[model samples]
Target chain A: MAGKRGGNLNWFYLLLTVVVLTGVGLMVYGQVGRGKTRAGKASMAPVNLAAMAEPDLIKAARGVNRGAESARVEVMVFSDYQCPACAYFATNIEPQIVKEFVETGKIRLIAQDFPLGGSHIYGFLAARAARCAEDQGKFWEYHHQLLALQNAWAYSRVPPVETFQSYAVDLGLDAAKFNGCLNSDAHADLVTANYQLGQQAGVTGTPTVFIDGRQSLGPNDWDVLKAEIERALGL
Target chain B: MTAAPADHAPGPPANRMGIALLALIGLMIAGYMAAYMLGLLGAIICGTGGCETVQQSPWAVFLGIPVPFLGVVGYGVMLGTALLGLQPRFLADRRIAAVLLAGAVAGFGFSAYLTWLEAAVIHAWCRWCLASAGIATLLLGCAIPEVKKLRRS
Candidate 1:
């Protein structure tokens, strides 16, 4: 009886060993895959710009934009700087969208601000910081940096204005001008207007997205957004 | 605690193996977070949307190292001692039990502190961090039996 019990225990050990080894193998594999993707995203390839006719919606939107203005489909994203889901959309999904549709001239992407003022302490400030970066024609660059490095300043105890300025400096923006703009809240009204516009559009939380003037896809689901974009393009 | 009596047998093999397995799981959780911290991973897919917030908070780091990396080290030690305790040559040794108990106590205390920080201070909870805390608690529970057996012996 004791011998049988030992044999069963040995089998259990063998199974556990296999499971643990497999788990480790999978983790290492995942890390390698993620490393390659991170490298690909690190380059921040420039977007292809085309000066097509600006649509009325593009003219009405109060935020930064990319892609040909005449692109058949419009994607307007209402996002907050401190929101994680928005960060995911910016870091993971937006690149693919920019590569596939924006560069290809099939879609125009506009990012509007919707800082959840009550919840995220620095959301409004981060939005203002991005606008300051925009003053130097580096809105997209500074925008991506803010989302990608959200963790660095999102929950900081003190205001992250210096960190915001440092990011501008890193992007090779005119440090003196960017600092002046940020310190004076040069774009406070613009950010506020965008927030009011988002509220008017019935957006309660970020990152609420509208494709071709119709609300679409929850945050972080790239495949769904891709399909919606395709359907809008009638492709 | 005094040195374990020389005549004491090592912990039951089942308990040692259990501890080892749990530590391995804890290591994986911490390893994932550490990788995320280092930017090897893209995003943390969490339901509550608080994982990144908690991780990004100033409290996420202790000293100069990320907290999860410290978790990786602690769990690694637990795993090593548990596996070593399973070896036949070490089966009669009590030092492994002592090390495991010490590690478990430290881990449990640290996990509790982090959990409190999540609730009381950070006001955000990362499920992965919570899961790590759960694993640390389990490690403490698993280590207790062996140490108790050593004490009685």
Candidate 2:
């Protein structure tokens, strides 16, 4: 009886082992072959830049807040939309600074593009998209939309030209004009100019803010920023 | 008259093989955990926040679960199975050893896929991830011979 049981047990183990090994082989093959499908799907999306406009920021960009200016210090922020830390700073820190400084006319915020090439594939496109929105007087609105969708861009294998357009559409932008602005090489030059300027200013990474030409090394909270602004202005 | 057969009969060679496999797995788990922790610390010190970038990437979450957390659970399960095999009271059936070997093979295959993604897609290598892959490969390689032995018996 014991001899019979041992023989049966051996057969069972051999069969199970084969099955497991086969399953693993199939999984590895599938992963390598099918992983590129996601990238293909992303590439097929339409590239419409007009879909990214925001009404509130568009109006402000067109000089509606021109009369509300406060301080004389110009704050130039060199940023990449696909950068997560930049997104965090834009959401958590930029708002307060804008409300207290930019909105109050104490500072004029100038956004400069500085896309990192290695990690963020669509970073340059997003920067160009923001500039395209600028032509329609919706620069700030488009900026916020790009930063808010940073994660979407970072993980996307294909460039997110279409995604940027969707943001313009949500903001009620003119589709034809937005598309024209996006496709034109005009904005590309502007993005390149910003990149050159950023490099010349010794900016090495995204979210490198220059308050009157002095670099803010990292994402500084509101208090440190406020102090910097005051000191820069000799107030 | 011949000496009586030794009382212990040196338990089956299969049991000894199982213990060795388990010890190898434990070593792998420890090596990988240490590498991951060190990589994270380096990223933090550099101020580039590369660690967050690597961690938040879609590859970091396989099937919506954190990979590191999954690794921890997998190692624990493997350790338990090894301990069960080591106990002398329970018969060290070849079938049980085969099943465990199969699991190790599956884990090795998955680790290979992850390593490919790290190189081709993510373009950033996490030293710890590489260490895990290496360990999984070694464990599977050693288990294959044991599996063959179980089959012949």
Candidate 3:
């Protein structure tokens, strides 16, 4: 009887300790990590241009392009439309580049599609939709729409192609033409080519940018990107 | 608080195997979620980048909260049931065994589904998630015979 009592007492202490430790640990860690995550500030990999010698500007890829064909500086971005990091770059950083460099004719900005496989359900579809929208001379508008309305349809269990069409309609694109292009998979080859180009450039992550031929070390901040552009342009 | 008197026979050896298995599963999932929720980027088990990708994916969340946190809650309840039944008088309770069995089945089913998604949809395997799946499966194995033993008693 004494032995049994001892065993029961041991079990009680062990369980008590485990429960208390779990509760306290959760509180501490939860408090620490919550703020950073909520701020939508996950760490971005720094752009690394140290490996290769820079190259002179090449003509932009065959997809949606902005700026002049003969621009001296080319900034090509490899991106997954469904990736949050890519969205962050598009919303916060790309605008600055466009305003300061792309629109001013100092640089030609090109977007290459590299929709991440698997978990990103609508990546390919969204890229395809943007290609279709591009067919009507509204490529940049459609690209912005996808990144802008990402929260609406990016996570849907089913493809959000209809939402893409609605965005096209909002842009005053020819709705019938857009639908035909989408249905026919008119730009399947284009999307595939973009992805293949990205892979060839050793892009393993989204929002990987190349200025001339040098890859971006980290393009999340505006000043860093500006400096990179200046260095590439020898300005 | 309800410690039995020294004269008790300790209630049929206390179903130690079943109790320990539940406790193990509960602790592992709790630790994994707590670490992740605390902002640890890499999975508690293993990750070459796959873990972070899986965690950041839409499937990782349910509604607005992370899904592993829900697994913690489920495991907590299962652990509570096992801890309560450790009392000498309740050690052989058929009701407790039945609840444990049900919890095991449910846990296993959910774990199985998530594992499948990781392979087919997510295209990345989080080792921690795989660990949870394994623990849930082992707990189910422990639970079936436990239910039988308590019922026979």
Candidate 4:
């Protein structure tokens, strides 16, 4: 009788293993593939990033202007350094945009801080750090370093302050000035000001791009963005 | 219910070593969970730097609370059952061993799911997370034979 019961139990164990393995395998595969796409695809409604009634050059703050201030077409970017989608845009697409229109002096790019406080761990600190770097005349270089190495330090439970310092050192900024600025929260107000500006503009997520004060489509795909920029430039 | 089968007399008792292992695993999970909630993980576990990534990801939470809190509860249940199995009164109940086996198997399945999540979705490896999975698997293995040795009463 014991032998008979043992035989039955073996079949049950075998069946359970097969079922569990099959269910888990499919779920993991599906979720992993989906995680790569950005949240930008879900919404196409162009955003103003501030609550102004009209697109005005006076009201829209172009804080970190990357191109000549006199450039005809101005592109404003509301972004969080710690955001995966924003990192994707900065690392892959922004370089090409810089090369084509920005470098040619046909366009001006404004980078505004819009750190999403809820999902990101180091978003606010990274924003302040970048602003500190900006004070020393190396904002874009520091921004590039942070976005390029998003995987390296974003996961830290504590703010990766030392990593930011290392970046400042690498960029050849005056360590005393940079460290003093970073430690004292010198750019905290600037970061907050940008975030408040974003809130007033009713911005929902990062990488919200505006062309000539008008919200454009998205930064996910290059061709759509290029056409939008071309239209703004009357090219 | 039928009487105890002539072929088996409840064997001896559930292996005590397995019970102790369950308790140790429970404590380990609790320790890791405390560090996670208190934001002290980096000072301790920084082997591959993957633990930080895995712990801070948005998926680390379930309904706004860290998922490791759930692991703590599961481990507590495991510890309770294992400790209970030490007494004659607890083992006297025919269903007690069965319950222990069921609990361990359920814990094993859950741990396996999380392992897959770390590997595929998170794209990071946490040594402590892997240790919990290994412990759960061992507990399940220990429970199976102990359940088999029970009489068909």
Q: Measured against the native two-chain assembly using Cα atoms, what DockQ does each of the candidate structures obtain, in the order listed?
A: 0.21, 0.05, 0.13, 0.05
Q: How much lDDT does candidate 4 score?
A: 0.69
For model 4, what fraction of the real interface contacts is kept?
0.00
lDDT tens digits, residue span B38-140, model 4:
5442111111255645665566676776778877767777666655555445554556677677777887898888788777666677787888888888888
What TM-score does chain B get in every candidate? 0.86, 0.67, 0.75, 0.76
Tens-digit lDDT string for candidate 1 (A1-235) = 1132122345556766886888789888977886685445322322211222134333444768899989998888888898877887899889999999999999999989988764377888999999888878999999999999987887677889999999999999999999998889677877887877776665666777778766663345777678878888998
Which candidate number has the best TM-score?
A: 3
- Ordered by lDDT, highest first, the candidates read 1, 3, 4, 2
- In model 1, what lDDT does residue A37 have? 58
- Rank the candidate models, highest TM-score first: 3, 2, 1, 4
Alpha-carbon RMSD to native, per candidate: 9.4, 13.9, 8.1, 12.1
TM-score of each: 0.57, 0.59, 0.60, 0.53
TM-score of chain A of 3: 0.74
Residue-wise lDDT of candidate 4 within A26-104, one digit each (tens)?
A: 5466445534433333334554444454345325434798888789998888888877667767877799899999999
* lDDT values, one for every candidate: 0.78, 0.61, 0.71, 0.69
Candidate 3: which pairs clash?
A46-A217, A46-A218, A47-A216, A47-A217, A47-A218, A48-A216, A48-A217
Candidate 1, residue B59: Cα displacement in angstroms equals: 9.0
Residue A181 of model 3, lDDT score: 86
Fnat value of model 2:
0.01
User: Which 10-residue span in candidate 3 chain B carries the lowest summed lDDT?
Assistant: B39-48
- Candidate 2, position A154, lDDT: 61
